[model samples]
Target: MSTAQRTAPAGADRTKHRKPPARRRPHRDQRWPASVFLSPWLIGVVALTLVPMAVSLYLSFTDYDLFSAPRWVGLRNYTDMLTEDPRFWRSVGTTVLYVVVAVPLKLGLALGVAMLLRSLVRGRAFYRSAFYAPSLLGASMSIALVWRALFNDGGSVTAVLDAVGLPADGWIGDPDLAVYVVVLLTVWQFGAPMVIFLAGLQQIPSTLYEAAAIDGAGRWRQFVSITVPMLSPVVFFNLVLEIINSFQVFTPAFVISGGNGGPADSTLFYTLYLYERGFTASHMGYAAAMAWLLLLAVGALTLILFRTARSWVFYADEEGR
Candidate 1:
């Protein structure tokens, strides 16, 4: 080879065989803005949520009344709960019944209302707003008071029962029926799930129903085969939410039952009982133990729902995959 060719810089060869560019990472400086925006949320979560939870967990293992420093009691609070506390078990059973009855009733009412709302041709927005107003109002203290009044012996509900020749009695004072009043109250606030069901219903194409009709499918058959499978995801979502919320129910029960879960403790929800222990009776350590147990129960139930959702929860986009 000529001296010129041999002496040529290796730059020419290096350029031809250069590797593809490495993927770029977000620059450290560029990440600062996002971190800055997230700092408040992170601080709130740590300071308000995580710290309180940690303190409560520690307190759960101790005997801490509000007036005195906590003394370590190991799992005595828990052991007492399982073996000694009849009220705790009663609260658990009442909370379970509330969840079982209220969730299905609420979801069923919401789904039924959603289907009716979906069929409207005019004033749909007005009807939606009207129906949603109850949920928007929420299970507030005033609402609970009003609910209690309405179920009182001389209230409107009793008046109606008397008019219909039905046994006229105040449900709030009836141990056998007081819990049902609470269930009805929860079911009344079904607008949130109803809106979700409505959204899911709207997403289903009319063509599916039309095709079903062409295939000689009845309305019930069309609903069973088409609407249900498509709406299963929304149903699952609402079911999980309702179950969680039901377990934590307290305000309505407290207000309606006069803060004692009264009339034989028929409306003694778990959270209400916890509140009575913590703040009312000054059993802070026991209450904290109850709270942690509640957290575990809710988490376990949520995990079970998620694990089982694979068998039923359908996502259209994931079908081909």
Candidate 2:
């Protein structure tokens, strides 16, 4: 064979033995299937939530009633709320009282109910549903109406008191008792926290209980030493949410008090007061200022709780931080 022919065949063999270059994978942005799936949620976030939040923030600085043009008032509204408004301070006091009293009571009842439900062997689902029904109905207009009727003078609650030979006054109308009724309403909606506690209870391992039992730990001891520590995270969660909800309470106070805050303005919650100012009294600018103040109050309280939680909350995972 000629040298040229031999060399040509060897080159062809080497070329054939070499592997082709690897094809590049598509870029992440080019993956249209995932983006198509997420498009609806993205649209909702931008259009419904983000836009409204931005608009509300902007409106909070202006004196805009529903019908009138928005006049920029700057910090005058804020100053009026803090310095010139007496009702603002009164409403703030009422809200602080409600939140401080209601949140702990609600969470305590929730934890107790959850522990009871966790221990029961039969018909657990039935009890859970029954307990949760009130929470589902909470904040409903119907429930508020029912509350008004129930606590009104000569209503069913009063009649029951009469049957038991106890004096019953206008619970919803009397200033002293009106706020208590609101607090009771908050406590009645303990079902959400109870459900969360139930989930937390189920997550605790049975071996811990068994070990406690082997050590002759009583039920109460096992609960305090084991259940509570394990459940601290859930407790913290319920506490934060309850505090936020209690501070934001409005419907019961509004409906039960006939939107006037009723009987010396005792049930004048912060939001209800803001509503009265903005919509009823036409103090839109001042009300907007109150709304921002409330937002700040809630945010500050939540931040404080989160900061304090490090001392109390126990996480099973080492990487919880």
On lDDT, the candidate that comes out on top is 1
> How many Å off is the CA of 277 in candidate 1?
0.6
lDDT of 2 by residue, 1-321 (tens): 588885455342245456332312233344697789999999999999888767766777888887788889777788877888788888988889998898889899999999999999998899999999999897898998888888889789878877888657858877888887788888999998999999999999999999999999998899899998999999998888888878888888898778888778888889999899888988776676777788888899899999999988988885566
Give the total clashing residue pairs for model 2: 0
Error of 2 at 265 (Å): 1.3
Give per-residue lDDT, candidate 1, residue 169.
90
Task: Compose the digit string of candidate 1's lDDT tens values, residues 100-171.
Answer: 999999999999999998999898788888888999665788898888999888989978978999767988
Cα displacement (Å) at residue 137, model 1: 1.7
Q: Where is the poorest 10-residue window by lDDT in model 1? A: 19-28
Worst 10 residues of 2 by lDDT: 19-28
The estimated TM-scores of all candidates read 0.90, 0.84
